[model samples]
Target: MPQEKPDLRNLAEPVRFKRALTLLLMTLVLPGSAQIAAGSKRAGRWAWRVIFGIVAIIVFLVLLSLVWRSGTINLLVSPKTLRLVQILLILLAIGWAALFVDAYRLGRPLTLERNHRLTASIVDGVLVVLVMSVLIYGSTIVSAQRDFVASVFGNGQKSKADKGRYNVLLLGGDSGADRIGTRPDSITMASVDAETGRTVLIGLPRNMAKIPFPAGTEMAKQFPHGFEWKNCGHDCYLNGVYTWAMGHKQFFPGVKEPGLLATSQAVEGITGMKVNYYVLIDIAGFQHLLDAVGGITVDVGKKVPIGGIGGPIKGYIQPGRNQHLDGYHAMWFARSRAGASDYERMTRQKCVMTAMLNQLSPQKVLTKFQAIASASKEVVQTNIPAGELGTFTDLALDSKKLPVSSFSPVPPLIHTGDPDFALVRTKVAEAISKSEALDKAASDGNGKKSNTPSKAPTKPATSGKPTGSPSKPSTDVDDVASICKA
Candidate 1:
């Protein structure tokens, strides 16, 4: 028996090299082809079937999107689907790894020359790594989405549009361990047309006092005329609504998010728009999110402070056009109020949002998906129903082509301290009308040029100075796409 031990060196030169090369090339072109060439043809046929099925499904989805965009997006973003996707990816990783091992087995590397066996092992190792890496990354995105969807949205019914519009209240809070409660420093209402997705941003000041609440809400009943903390003297600012409401949580009864609910009521009263949902984002935590998308590009109008609040001045963002900003600098770009008015800060924030929306292309999202998903989970908290997420996603994609116009109820237009509710409503209505009219005009223009697709939205010019008039400090409305154009 010992004498019968054979050596691969006995194989003919042609048989050794040709057979190994054929197997390696087969697997490279078709993952299971090596098995068909040497092992069970049935197994290889099944692998081919799976591969074809995956491609077919992807093609079907692409076609579905053209016909029923919202339905496709909804199905894609659904948390349940994401969970199933995670499971499928894990299974795929295992299955593909097995096919690779089987391909190497069919190569009969053990019976080849030492150099040929070494080459086979290296190729197999590389294939395994590439396959596993992609699967793991895909799994990470699904997991992140699952956790985020569970944490942020409820399993509530989809909300209906109000008068052909969906209004969402966006609140930015700068809370730290040292802080007693959250103070919503920035409040903005996004009124989006139900069909066209055209949006009008209404910025509200944090220092606004006597904010009116809805007629029958808890806060309305408590403050009757408006949100006034006369007992706390002059500290009853609009931003303090959350902190004040948190102290009186008993009044909210069974409300899960008492602070957010209270602020939504105040925002509804102030904007004269019924908010269907609210998103409370932590300003400090937003930096990580910016970094995840490889930072956002912004047209820095002025030299903005980096880190000056509750600490020494760190640095400044120099004025520039199309400046690429990281997490730390972008946070300051949106928030820094040092040597700048709050109105100016809001304008910068709006520009930042617009820049992010424009620059965050689909390719970038796919490549940095894991980081974006992880960062989003930490910063954003919302009451938007999970079922409606797909609809909003589709709307956002459609809205990208349309211009975004902004209106801030500041200074000469309407005093924040004693804002005229009637006048504010009128201005908001007019802004909405103007935005719709512009969209209609753009559509008509595009139709006239039927042979060509619509061009990118134009941006407004940028000046380092405040967006408002220097002499009178009046509210200014402009296209954000133009304002943040690179």
Candidate 2:
């Protein structure tokens, strides 16, 4: 009451609130998962506070912007997404705090600045985050992707009978050429059972020979008068088959050719499931997907050299041991081979893919939801409708143990003229057979089996498994190429 000259803080109020709001928004919107819990705790830390704060804040802001659409709110997310959102938020808060410190240093009176600076910064950050969270979660309430497969897949309702087991085709592509005839480097089929919550991932090497497409004999036919039969590694390259047959007809998503259709048909015939869901993630798309997932943790089984492959992947990298990698590095790990054998590459691909999946969960992806979704759209072409996709996710949410197992089928069971190709084809077919039977068994048991099947089965912890070269040791087999400098 000593008649303090009418505290002219009104004009400053918006400025104060502005700073706070900006910080808050940055905090919530950021994509780092750490931001959610340690937000307050991180604020109390000492060394390199500015770095942590800014990094977190920037991450949160990016994530927040990603979550909330321009005009929509879609915050009702599962746990993993939520956790990711929170982590991102914390990162944003730290970022905001750093900026706040800078603002205070450039400005005036210590008492006022100190009194309001931190509070203003964090509150503002939280408010912005809250608003963004709501928007991001709300917009996708009826995600379009959910619609494409909804009619057939059901809305996470219905009895076990409706859920059924599934055979999903996962294609990893290196479209060095146009999308038209680019072959898939890696092919994986996943068998998932909702009731049992079991999942198995099997790998198909690129050079597999003697692949029988679902089109019966029709799949092997050449395109035109002078066009070569689509025979690539075996009688025909898988990619060529797609362009030759499916591209013109447009039967599947990103199916540019009948290759996918034929492959699907073959798998369906083998598994007896409609082969309901197909996800084609090209190399670029796969890279983006891994990037969106914030990189993955993988293990290097042995000393490996890279950059020897004839294409863009020619270089030698000696990874020290089990390590972590971001999107680009992971891609390299999946595709590199200075001294790696083909079988080694197969193992590496599976390891990288599994590591990528392990990184996603409801609680971990909330903040980065939009980026993930965007990345998914660009990188992946899936046949499962959006609604069905949601159901699949929801089912994943419910169960822990899925019924499945995976292994390459390309063992050199028999010697052949084209040794490597023969082994690859054999393994791919064998893997497909195993996956199909396991998934069918799960589906059949959904109604007849336990009311609640656990989550998908976990691949045994082979984090330290070696990436070994495979050559047919059969009496009649021949090595394709001499071992590279390992």
Candidate 3:
């Protein structure tokens, strides 16, 4: 009984194959375990220490995130932290692959039968590829995220929430070879409560004239009365402010983006709300984003024309329920004004936006993250700092569950040619107050609607033309859901 000392390096064929597979499994489960069992204890100990440290750090971060979400998110998104993560992942891939190789060596693969050797080799190769590929892919995603954060968000001074709310100007820029310069075709300020994420979207018609700039801004000093050009008749509009400011860069010395600054100031003056940040989206590139999420499903209320602003109409998004639109059609759905008034087009744009927000699930986002990230870089440019991304992202998630109210200074409510700035501000305040009251009522378990009525216009204006104003004055809609119906 004492004479039989079994050799691990030269075992029976079946036993040898079994041993080899066991070793590989051990390495797969916990890198270096196989090495410690059969090979060098020193290398295995080092590997184990590294793996344990990584796990401990990850656990600590998870716990920290539970208590300090924004800080953890900011730290993760930081350039240095991302770089460190990228390098660590690469190192882990290489090291873990090495461990698998070492485990194979410890299995004495050469001594096994030819068939057993082949089988062990295939299993070892698969485990290495499986482990290494995931780690490498993770590193790549992290790198992409770092690059995205750097390129999309500015390193601007952080803005605090103004009066328990953050007012962000969303500009849809329309720039083409046919135009002189980029003009903001869509101008909406999304005012969100800092706590509850209650939102009020204040839309200003691109054709709205007589836009005043904030008091201290240079634009205000230049145009003491309001935004106006000497002889630029209908061309001097709200959207043209961007192009105008770009042309007059001398007025905003030391400012990097004078156009955006001018526009934000104009929004502040119009809304009587502080402009905390601005996200300018290129309208043409917006299709890419819609395509990334596998397109969106919206209830198309009317036949939205594809292209007819300066060219012939290409096609139409026919009226339908639960209509699934690709990027191209969705872009046209949001931007088209052909055979439709500006206010009608604005309503359609809000519908598209709402549909996107409601339908874009977290699972879909994760699955299509790479495409979304790439498209977002192309579509969006924002003054919101990288540090505040986590906070705003949280708010956006909260906003999806809440009702979104919208107000536009269009038609009978306020004339685009000669807008009453005072009336516009009052409407803006009323919209915000209504949104807050709704949020409060929801929190208090009161589903009853606000009974307050808006101040109606004494003389409702009417227009005979298709592109002209509607007969009824525009009023604030408490919830966009009712308006965006199929």
Candidate 4:
């Protein structure tokens, strides 16, 4: 008898559709499984290997994070690692999309009924689009991070802190295309304890006169007495020092950032603390960054003006508790200087910083990764080296466990116009001592304390005293988070 003819009947239309759907879904849930079921076994095997490799990396990173968080953070922020990860993400996306197409081919939809063929094609197309979209989006985020790292950091070795504390000069300034030079409108020194991450913010008024530079710096030599520019009628304010230094770059010959260096030295001289580094934030672009992270919530102490300094007054941010503000409103809230006293503005700015620190948790950062990464590149410029970021990052995390207290040398504590450097340094030391004592108490009590540390002094002290009384201390220091509770 003739050999039995092989059956050539096509699978039922419904059966073909169901198989196509299964293969498409399988490829999505477990890339390459569909190929193993119906296509080239070799391709399927390769796909599995890729999947396993990715899974292994994820597990390794997770383990590293749990065991050595600081190391993990450093590695993640490393420029070389970031570049490598960006390339790998793109390759993974391309490979995943190809796998979806292969799964469709293995299904052999061409031999199925017309309707089933159309349905399979649609499913295959959708899977490709979805996988590509997600992978490409992730790759973009990685690329942004890499660019940000490269732009902001140098290769300088991490500097050691002085007296177990790192004093960083934080400047908030506005630089417009129409404007001449950047003015550091808001000046604050962040004194962070190297061991405990306890912090104290020392605020200085912008218009404070007789600002002195470091002992050996060029600015100090030129002024000798202080930052007194003769052209400004022998009265140069703190903020104007930047503009003066910029104009008189010859005084700081060969220096790349004369203004910044001079300002850093001025802050050092004023606070009587060694300045580790400086961070200058552009207030004009500040709103964009704030909006990117879904705006910040702050306790509005009073009505803050929106505009009216240069142009017409727009409106006012009404006083309220826990007011959620968008980028435009948040910038105005921090910067509006029309009606509010400079000291009040400084206090409000401190509150803004406190609110941001508490609210911009890890979860929020991850969720708004793209917007934040983009905005960071535009808004922030700092001398903080890439090598030192991990140290500061670890310290910042530690700082969150305790309240952030601030000291403003605006009024009765020390006259800003003619600040007594010795007195300022004494008060700063006293503040640090208080913080250390509080930490000691917490440790002694095994994380249980009957009374939290008081934010301010309960007794007043005479001027020039090393340790002010409780009432006087209140003027200089405050638990910003509690004061600006939302």
Candidate 5:
């Protein structure tokens, strides 16, 4: 009875095997527990400190995000913070894997049966691989985000919100080997309320003539009258403003993007809204962006050509209801103008924009973040500062919940060939005023009966319609969702 005690290292095969598994399981759950229980207490204590420290930091960040969202986002987006996190993840992966190995040694695998030893080895190897793989993958994502933020933003000057709104000029730059340089094919100004996130999209036809430059600006001193090329005739239009400025870069001394600056000035002079920033999207890279989000769905009212502006028509995205389109077809849907008028094309472009805004959910973004980041780097060019990304991102998420109103000066409303600048400015002001009124009403809980149309105007005619033929163009739409709906 006095010799009943059994040695832990000399237990039966089944007992030894069970003990080995228990140690491995403990290491998996808490890296240093096995070490403290059976091995070096010093190493186990250090590992425990690191694990606790990491948990503390994570819990602090989570709490911070709940109370101060933008602050947390800024911390995450900071390049310095990202580098620190990446290094920490790598070290943590290595240290955690080492702890698992140490735990395996503490299990005394060699003392077990052959089958037991093999089983323990396999389980330890799997746990190490799984843990390391997750940490490494997270590090890669953080690295990609850091590179994306660095490359895409911070080139442009920072701007403050003018009054209660932020006006951003969105340009769709079209360039090819056939063309000499990039031209902004699509021009839209997204004016967002700084507080409520209420948004109004103001569109300018690419062919709009007589675009004026803001007073006291360099563009104003050069083009005092309006944007016009004498011999170019009708060829000189809003889109050509970029090409013209690029040719006259000397006028904008020390400016990085003279073309963009000049174009922004022109937009300011036309819309009478101060431009806070500009985002230029290369049309060629747009398809990649659409594909990254697994494509978008849109109601195609008329056929859209694949490639027919300068070349033969490759194909047509046939008209249908709730058509799910891949990157290629969606790009064509947004850019095609083969038989469609510019106004028709603009409507479709807005539809595509609305579809993207409504369809790109946060879940999709998290799952396809790598692909989206890669595509965005290639597709987007902006002057928006890296510091303001958190605010804008938060605003963007807020905007998704509200209706997006749109205004486009088209035929009957205004002549692109002989645009009335005074009338254009008036309409722009009216649209913004209406959006603000609706936002106020909604906030006051009295917006349900508001007269603003809830649906977007019907799609413009694409085929068998002459450029001058008047289509039913609503001067403004209160909700773009109706326009984009199937």
Candidate 6:
């Protein structure tokens, strides 16, 4: 018998169109292609499927526009509706998990079973609509809430800046109800390079000393009466810790709030950068804020399948790689010290942030939109100015192609000292040298790196304790001390 001719509909497209369509799916994964990939057995399977797929995708786009706003604002979803949606998402996730495994193992266009036109047409069509809706709506909620939550939690008091690179001192504190001692968790100097639109984060281990800030004479100037700002027995350096350059007297009649000037001044002097802003959040505040923003998105990676205690995750977000983290999990990820040390914990914190950024991608945010917006309630705090926020949005969106850079604690050159203030001074001096170099390069317009990139970064002479968030803040000289002592 002669070979049978292929159906016109099932026949593949011309070389160029096929190649273009395939390329588009590789990155875009449009709903139509997804539905077409479902089943087979039709006479004009390819043509008919693609046609229907386009129509379905249009539906997906329209649905996305309708629910986009719901993701950003704190919409009141009826509990019943919310539960139903959650259940549907769960079911979709299961289906996605199956498809995901197959796609990974077999690769695309690799057939899994005999094509079934009728079944594939119906199921694929429904699934495409359902999945697309979740993706678009979910992500929109998460991203919008992530940025705005900072303003809400800070109580209308966020960081401020102008057209140039803006700097902020990010501080983490260990204050908690169960804490043995209250101290800074970690300090990082962070800066946003407006020109390059890149973010730079630096970690300052609290253990390092000889920092600068509490000007040696600050004691005499601000707290001539003592460190007690509102009360005679209050912590002397407490107030100064939150606002850069503020002065205070010694507390405990003689005991100091560590060294006041050494750490702060050293940081300012070394980085050659100004101490424009600072803020301190207690452990409770950090944890509470995270809970408020519905929690951040975290990706589970081979890096950490088994947690600090070798605990099994009952669907603890699978270990391979994923995003969307809640406060509870993120807290442990950043704070877990079981098998990891303070340094390792900082790295984990950075990972959490990176995962958040990945999930915030335009395509992903649309799915988790509602949860993201609701969570933004108490999770973040910053000092970036309102005017700069619009600019920042543009910069962040463009950051995809921008080269991201980060540095580690400098070594041997700096160390913690007996008098806390003395060690702070040393750190400040080291940072100043760096800041000055960058400033000069920026002035000359010969620098490809940001105006705030660390001039130099090396492991500290010794392993020290972490005192702030994993990474440093933008434009902060006192970050090292802030993270360590917060």
Residue-level lDDT tens digits of model 4 in 151-214: 8788755768998889889899877776779998989889887866878888788978887777
Error of 6 at 297 (Å): 8.6
Q: List the residue pairs that clash in candidate 5.
A: none
For residues 1-486, could you state the per-residue lDDT of candidate 1 as single tens digits?
A: 367534546878558767776776676568678778777799889888888988898999999999988898778778888888899899888878888888777667777778878887888888888888989888987888788777777786677999878998888898988788888888888888777777778888888888998898888888887877674356677888888888888988888778898898888888788999888889999999989888876656667787676777789988866577888888888888787788877777777776666667778887887787778878998888888887887777766656677788888778878889888888888888777666555565345311112332354322221221111122555566555432
Score residue 7 of candidate 3 by CA lDDT: 84
lDDT of 6 by residue, 1-486 (tens): 897744334544343234333422431353223333432224224434554764796577567646543222222232333344455445545555344333222222222222433333334445545666665455444345444544443323444443355555656655545543445565655555555455555555554432333344443344443334353233323322423222323332452333323233434533545544544445445554455445554434323322434454323333332344566666665655454445555555554444444335555444445444444333334444433344545555544433233443533333322234344444444444444444455454554544333333322111112222333222233323222211
Q: Which candidate is the best by TM-score?
A: 5
Worst 10 residues of 5 by lDDT: 461-470
Per-residue error (Å), model 2, residue 36? 33
User: Model 5 TM-score?
Assistant: 0.91
lDDT of 2: 0.48
RMSD of each: 5.0, 12.8, 6.3, 6.2, 5.1, 14.6
lDDT per residue for candidate 2 within 184-213, as digits (tens), equals 666766755544444555554454444453
Model 1 alpha-carbon miss at residue 255, Å: 0.9
Cα lDDT, all candidates: 0.76, 0.48, 0.81, 0.77, 0.81, 0.42
Q: How high is the lDDT of residue 328 in model 3?
A: 93
TM-score for all predictions? 0.88, 0.54, 0.90, 0.87, 0.91, 0.43
Candidate 3 local distance difference test against the native: 0.81
Better of 1 and 5 by lDDT: 5
- After the best TM-score superposition of candidate 1, give how far the Cα of residue 380 lies from its true spot, in angstroms: 0.9
Give model 6's TM-score versus the native structure. 0.43
True-structure lDDT of candidate 6: 0.42
